[model samples]
Target: MTGGSGGHGGGRGGAVAAVDLGATSGRVMIGRLTDGIVSLEAVARFPNGPVPHADGLHWDFRALFEHIVTGLAEAVAREPQLASIGIDSWAVDYGLLRDGELLAEPFHYRDDRTEAGVDLVHALEPFDELYRRNGLQFLPFNTLYQFAVDAPVAEADTALLIPDLVAYLLTGARVAERTNASTTGLVDVAHASWDTALAERIGIPPTLLPDLVSPGTHLGRLTPELTARVGAPLDVVTVGSHDTASAVVAVPMADPATSAYISCGTWGLVGVELEQPLVTDAAREANFTNEGGVDGRVRFLHNVTGLWLLSETLRAWEDEDGAAIDLPALLDAAAGVDGPVPLFDANDPSLSAPGDMPARIAAVLRSAGAQAPVGRPAFVRAIIESIAQAFADAVHTAARLTGRRLETVHIVGGGSLNRPLCQATADRTGLPVLAGPVEATALGNVLVQGRALGWFGDDATLETLRATVAASVTPVGYEPRNGGTSL
Candidate 1:
């Protein structure tokens, strides 16, 4: 458990490619489902982040689209038998299109441009009522809020969330994958369809919405023009287009009803997967989101600010040092810190933006009557503990809201590799923490495609895919410490 191995692998059989995109990075991997083993082999990876524009923070969709095509082409070349491909990315940010052409670059969700949108929408329908209709947590950057103030959306004839946008460009298809579309706050919670009335009430054109599709549905093969460019005419399969939803699909939980999951990457999507949505007032009051899941399940989770804090803080310190810090060495040093380090609220709004993260975190600490961390080790310790604390809090709230005797916490995605953070979460939550399958998003994407290709047959449930995952990867285990909730 102290060490790990395998970022990509080499294998081939009933193969499919997964184009998994995160807020900060993107990768294309080939997944082979054979001999009861689901294996992944990396094809390509590229950097992704906010690109400052004259307007505000925006994603470089042009660059990302090129990278994705190149990656998929490389993947196809590597695995000639690759059956199909699926795409997934961070949710709630989208591109607008007019006459099948993008009107503008998609705004980064982190951009501080949604305040006006929030005000404008809540004026039409208060957040409480909106939640009743949509079941989305009140994120200022939810696509519905963004549409409230995005002038370009008024002119665009179609709106596509990130993965849908990528799929559309590749296949000439204009369908919104349901999992990601649910994050837009324009999908009805109870019905799992577009809330056209809500759109019109808020002054967004309903025509901009596209047909909704489910995971494992075949979107289309690459258009012939795209085929010549990408080197193949492979079909595009819809997975859980939302990255968190896909990550949840590969949680490796044998019994989801008794376990909670933290899809810990840029954000800690902490919650449980349920047969149906949990939309009680208590759930809404706790800021839990009832996002759509594959197989018509519900991702009843809350989004706690996650590893972005540590990543941004690292960026700040690296700037000051003029070199990249050794993350493992720093974390090892942090793990040896003697006692409880000063903790700050990990979900503080002031800490959300980019730049000077250490200063901003310290300022928050000082304002909260805690001593500022004196050195890098202590600072890192503080960061880990604070984030772990937030994760623990969210896990407890999810359990209480859902009325489950949560027996396990599954930490997947990049944060699962942080041994100290996982241990701290186990300690704080007083529950066993199971962590690994770091590429769960890609695995889920691949699993869905594999099923679509009949590798698991048509009746394979998310649980079946997850069981295959369990058989493939061994998750590291952490037991609760003697002093519960203490580092």
Candidate 2:
């Protein structure tokens, strides 16, 4: 066992562990399902972020695997009667395997390699045509463009996205989990299957993609090697492998038509879930995405730059011995400050890369003809306000473009832990807010795993589980006194 810890049965009596990897951190949660309620306990957690390197930002795959093994050991010690395991991670970035070995360290999606590939990709398949066919956004780091940036496709035997790579390591199985695969901009929107023709056109061999699997397909058991090494029973099952898809699966919407969602975290994905891809020019012009979701749903959302702005700002402040600045107190201070600068463009590419965020915000404001904040609290407030304003605009555009009257916005994920952000979002959007079920990604992972094992009846849809675990938070109204802020 990686951690060499011990225990009896823990998760739901029907124990299933989930390995949920996010960009900033990773955790192994042991879930317990008894009767109809699900309970979760964290067996282990560790920092899991990008490693800066000369070639580009690379993932610490070895370290992540070590941590996973250690966490599994702990989970087994605590809940010896484990049923199955599933993994979900951020989308697009992948691992290359050749001759049964990982070819090289997986490149982080934020790497500059993709910077030069967008025009080339557009040249091969015009953006509008590609959008009509695939229904994905024009992110620079999508797997299609990322692969286009590489020298040649013949260099690798297989390309496995993050969650698939992790599953392969766990169960010696290799298949593209459908939900995450759709985010690569290479999947057929209608079928949620890999697009071989597109792959050929982009110069990547079709064989590089493994057979695709739906969310709950059983891959296999944990290898005998892992069983002996860890001395515990292990099982591997597929969940919504894309973290956002999993989160959406657990969105807690009472009715799909009336609900909009903000999978608030490192990135704030704001939009509604639809039965089909809304591939209209207006949807395209609004830059909204029709990302694939569980049960043949389309997650029509925009990938808004989220708390990264605030988190980065806080990091810079911490560097200046500003650790004692409590967030609640900071928000109070920000509320006291008057006349926030007009909404600034939150999606500026300059804000996309990592650096001094406070300085970046200052620069963005100056360029936009808005004055920089007088102090740190003011700056933080400006960022929060601007993000909310942006959300407001997106929600309106989403409604107009999709013809769906979204009655509420459900904010889930790590960023939902920020109360002021939620309140500001609610105020800015002028819609009721429901926050929490903070473990949205993990819960979604577990629900799919649960369904796979037949723990619940066939009628145990994701919406049912979401409704069971969801908690709601209402808006703390904020009305613009002078004038409504605008970007």
Stretches of model 1 off by over 4 angstroms after superposition = 1-13, 483-487
RMSD of 2: 4.7
Candidate 2, residue 425: the lDDT equals: 82
Q: Which lDDT tens digits does candidate 1 get at residues 18-126?
A: 9999999999999988898999999999999999998899999999999989998998888887878899999999999998999988999989889899999999899
Task: State model 2's lDDT.
Answer: 0.80
Go through the candidates in order and give the clash count of each: 0, 6
At residue 56, candidate 1 shows an lDDT of: 97
lDDT of each: 0.89, 0.80
RMSD after CA superposition, every candidate: 5.1, 4.7
lDDT of 2 by residue, 331-417 (tens): 778767776455688888899877798888889888989888788777878888888777778888888887777777788898777
lDDT of 2 at 339: 66
